[model samples]
Target chain A: MASQEIETLAQALARLPGFGPRSARRAVLHLMKRREAAMLPLLRALEAVNERLSTCDMCGNVDTSNPCTVCADPRRDVRALCVVEEVSDLWALDRSRLFPGKFHVLGGRLSALEGVRPEDLSIDKLLRRVEAGGIDEVVLAMNATLEGQTTAHYIAERLERFPVRLTQLAHGLPVGGELDYLDEGTLAQALRARRPVS
Target chain B: MASQEIETLAQALARLPGFGPRSARRAVLHLMKRREAAMLPLLRALEAVNERLSTCDMCGNVDTSNPCTVCADPRRDVRALCVVEEVSDLWALDRSRLFPGKFHVLGGRLSALEGVRPEDLSIDKLLRRVEAGGIDEVVLAMNATLEGQTTAHYIAERLERFPVRLTQLAHGLPVGGELDYLDEGTLAQALRARRPVS
Candidate 1:
């Protein structure tokens, strides 16, 4: 008979994203198929992350170190900070090799419907970091979603009196995205911000 | 920014069934989001499984102990033995609770196409177990695939000298399967194996 431990492992796997009951079972079976090469490494990795993983106190990005690799790096521009809704967005931007500046993770967007308040986010720390005076620019790189825009507006208002100049990531049809699939709001905004041929 | 550790963790999750680059990244984010509740528990579970999970020496079923809980159980029918290609099949049969007998996991089916030989499977051990004899009946529970059938036929030939009554799992329209979607092979098998109404 299948042991209780296997069932419990499947239950835990089901809670992870991209896994349902069937997929969890499949994953467990696959793990059983290769206990040493795949499963053991995964177990060890999970244990390592569990022990060492923590969010940077300064930027709110999840990392192994407290200050995070990006925040701790001397090469990155501390004067220019990119503020995003989550750590994933920060990673995506960093992966592009376009942003050499440090980041501030907002934790999540302003979701009044979900009863999330400004206090729920790292906004206060962001404002304090900006007001503490070395930062010259604040890039509000929240998503284009309604809540994201709402959060950006709220942050912009909060930082109105600060010496730091505020900015936002551009919104338009995504690169390589089909024009036919582009929403009306994006199309309108793209047209309004249309650049002339250089 | 995402640290090297988080990236390593995501890479490990990607090796598991159903997770890819994007989904692995998402899983890592979700883990970071719920560190106290979900991630920690998963780590502990993985550690537990890693430390304890092993194959039973007698039955070849994966479990926490050497002989496994099922093989050690005295109440289960020792006379009837269900033979399957993998531990997963044993688990499936056990979950159904239709069989109260013990199991013998063959590890894998014969597949010349995939370079899997008779020597690759635990067929010798299975034969040894049967020859030791208290096993009155042996049920062949391999999958419906070509490899499973080939393996079953090979095993039947090997067990020809034994006094054990050999049988197989019944093939038919699945309990809830619709006729329209059923293949001709299944339909024919179902027709051939049709039973009288009680």
Candidate 2:
């Protein structure tokens, strides 16, 4: 249906998290059509990132710099550290502008089925960061999955002996989540953690 | 939320047909994680295509070769040409292997809303191809939209003097379309084109 180069590009694109074969094909066609406006820019950006990409030595966040933007920023609160499962989680949290602190990426959570044990993650690095002593609070902002909770709990136990306070994200109905469509666990959590009217 | 290079990559990816900001971010992260497996291959493919890309002078098809793969294939029925609105349409038609003939891409259809005129397309070139000789049939394989039909009609009018047979794709229910879910226009077309049972 197309050239080998176009097919290869589509195959690589289809491997992305949200894209399929049809969408990848569409994307390839679009890129081919808009070579100057889209294709060249994307190629240049990818090459630049690939050439300069590095992980933060302090946290596990990926950036062109060794310390990452968040870790190197003096304006960010060094006393408050947020722990997350991956770099994407860190980005999601940072996008909110609510957490004015640095982040620690665990690389991945403990998953028995996937054989991702505690040793597989950057737990020792996280412990080392806490032990280095200036952080006041450690927020475990893991997902609401069972594995996420298990990882949070394990991290909490390790940080208990440290002077810094350990906290996890509050579980309840998400903003704009319809009560009728929500699951029983979410409803129960929302009810148990009900807030008083001001 | 990310560095300039990663953000630029995400923005460029988001401009793709099916991708949005969120999906683009996820794709960027995926690319970053599997740089060797995914990102480098995509970059290399893009570079190779960019450097070697050419349009067929005869058929307007895009390929590394000037004649393109379809136009260069000696086995294809050159006497029977399939005219389509875009390169993507040509690819779609060829993917089915139902059209053994060559293809001519119009670049786009006549669209009053978008200000696309007949002159803006490859219609003149199409007429030249038909005028230059031994073509027996020209299949008008435009989309089912109003603009598509209008463009097809305009082309048919221009080709009325030519000795070649001009044909079009049939309008009916799609292969897997359900009768209950089908629109009135399709149902009417299907009924009007009803065939005798074997």
Candidate 3:
């Protein structure tokens, strides 16, 4: 009943994350139903983002502004830079509201099997930023994966010459986590990192 | 890390059917990544659809033209009218290529508990169309639900005076459907509608 143009649009929408063939067609129809209220606004927002968005040259954070809002803000502690593997992680951490510092996105962890090398990531850029003097600590807030650990170790070794403190997120039972469902590795790490009643 | 505007855009994108908060943010980033390849084309498609689309007065099919592509096509068999519950169903039936006829969308099935009245649907319009003559067959291609059957029966009673033959889709195990998992009702229907082992 719809036109070929609409069909083409549905096909494109299918390629987006979380959209399959059925859902893509449904989404296209939903968009058509909300033509004025939602469709045009989404289109306009996408256009605005496309026109102005880019990765931050300093920290690799994604935003419409060149340096990104975080890097541009003076209130953030320049002495403490939290390192993450991706912008999504950075956003997650931002939502956590635990960190009051800036960030450096490595883009991805070093994966030898996947051909992801240290040079493949923004590691050099991060090193340069840290080398410029001002940052006193680098927080390794990478994911709890082997590749993440490898990247963290590599970065720590590289930053050994610099006079900055190196730290990482503690390994423990996650907040609201169930001990019965936890793996042995996590349990052992939690036990090893446990402190007295204080 | 993104500006307030970009963040607002991501929030809006999150409201789409298949996209959650995280995937919506990812979708905005994806749109930015594929600005030329996907975003522009999708935007153009939405604009074109908005500019030209509306429901066909004849069949209730939503498309870029007033009469809709199906109703406007002279090649379609106007004599065999297929009735469906919604435009999405119409689209799905159209995709099947099994029926080469026009359509009538009822918008929704009768639901006593939900306070759905016959006057709330396009039943009057359908009756008027049928009364005008030239239609030889009317296929009640509604979903095989209690409400759908109720609607079909009501339509049949209303058009009792019409000379057109009334028909419906057959009930059976779906193509590639496993018999072991099928419901007793479906198995009984499949047995009743059995043909030569072809």
Measured by lDDT, the strongest candidate is: 2
Once superposed on the true structure, which residue ranges of model 3 sit more than 4 Å away at CA? A113-116, A175-188, A191-198, B73-75, B112-115, B171-198
Strongest candidate by TM-score: 2
Error of 1 at A73 (Å): 1.9
Candidate 2 C-alpha lDDT tens digits along B1-198: 578888889999999998999989988988888888988888898888888788889888887677788998888998999999999999889989999898999999999999999899999999999999889999999999999999999999999999999999999999999999999999999999999998
Report the first chain's TM-score for all candidates: 0.94, 0.96, 0.95
Best by DockQ: 2
Stretches of candidate 2 off by over 4 Å are B112-115
Note the residue pairs that clash in candidate 3: none
Would you list the rank order by DockQ, best first? 2, 1, 3
Question: Which residue pairs collide in model 2, if any?
Answer: none
Q: Interface RMSD for each candidate model? A: 1.8, 1.1, 2.0
Instruction: Residues B89-159, candidate 3: write the lDDT tens digits.
Output: 99889988889999999999999988898998899999999999999999998899999999999999998
DockQ of each two-chain model: 0.62, 0.76, 0.51
Report the CA-based lDDT of candidate 2 relative to the real structure: 0.91
Q: How well does candidate 3 score on lDDT at residue A107?
A: 89
Whole-model alpha-carbon lDDT for candidate 1: 0.88
